[model samples]
Target chain A: MAAANENITADAIEATEFMELSRKYRVTGVPKTIVNETIEIMGGLPEKMFVRQALEMPEE
Target chain B: MGLLSPQDEATLKNHLSGITIPVQLVLFTQAFGGSESGDVAKQILNEVASLNDKITVVEKNFVLDTEDKAKYKIDKAPAIVILSDGTDTRMRMYGAPTGYEFVGLVEAIIVAGTAVIDLDPETMKWLQAVDKPTHIQVFSTPT
Candidate 1:
């Protein structure tokens, strides 16, 4: 997604390495994604579903 | 000792053969008060760079290179910023790129090296339509 848009910046952080960040974001499990510090994805979803939720798009 | 086996090197070379543009991996690692994963990340990046002529690793000191750290907006000890032909890809990886993260690093490299994004067309459309700044942080464990 970051590659697709210049205004987007994506960071892949290791939960164990960044303990403070993990705790701050309430990352209780692996593969948790936080978008814009608000949208939280608990687990890995399908590609389209993940993208939609990350972008806050309405489901079709 | 190198991390990749001989067969793995050959396979990786073939996989990276399609790269036409140069991909620069700007890695930041703190020499002091940093985790051992910093060294591990460096080793993994070096092994990956060895596989493709178009790939290069540019190391930076996380403590000393203040300007670079700010430029890349890297607040952590170890981070990787992928650039495609001198352009920022806005893709970053924190921590050691081992285990499943290694696969992601390879995929990001391919995207950077080829200037291609293999997203679905619909997803691409949605992404391209994004007019505001979007910050995405994905957290994962090594296992």
Candidate 2:
């Protein structure tokens, strides 16, 4: 998503390495995605479904 | 002794052969009072770069390179900023790129080098239509 748009910046963070961030976001599991610090995705989902949830798009 | 075995190198080299443009991996690491993973990150990046001629690793001091740190908005050590032909891709990886993180790094490099995002057409449309600033942070363990 970051590659497709100039306004998007994506960061892949190590949960164990960055304990503070993980704690701040309450990440107890792997593959936790936080978008704009507002939307939280707990685990991996299908590509289209993940993108939809991440973008907050209405489901069709 | 390198972390990647000879066979692994060969496989990675073959995978990286698809890149047509230069891919620069700008790595920031602190020299003192930093985690050992920083050194590991550097070594991993060097090994990855050694496989592909078009890929180069540029090292930066996390403490000393204040300008670059601010420019990339990097707030931590061992952060990797991916650049495609000298242009920022806005893709970053924090901590050591090992295990599954390595795969993600490779994918990001491919996207940056080729300017091709491997997403569904509809997904691409949604991403391209994004108008506001979006900051995405994905957290995962190395294992």
List of chain B TM-scores, one per candidate:
0.97, 0.98
User: Against the true structure, what is each candidate's TM-score?
Assistant: 0.98, 0.99
Q: Evaluate residue B13 in candidate 2 and report its C-alpha lDDT on the 0 to 100 scale.
A: 89
- Model 2 chain B: ten consecutive residues of lowest lDDT: B110-119
- Local lDDT at A30 for model 2: 88
Model 1 misses residue B103 by how many Å?
0.7
lDDT of 2 by residue, A1-60 (tens): 899999999999999999999999999998999999999998989999999899999888
**Model 1 reproduced share of reference interface contacts:** 0.88
CAPRI rating of model 2: high
Best by TM-score: 2
Scoring only chain A, what TM-score does candidate 2 earn?
0.95
Q: Estimate, for each residue in B1-143, the C-alpha lDDT of model 1 and write its tens digit.
A: 79889998899889899999999999999899999999999999999998888999999999999999999899997999999998999999999988878888999999999878999999999999999999999999888
Model 2 stretches with alpha carbons more than 4 Å out: none
TM-score of 1: 0.98
Which candidate wins on lDDT? 2
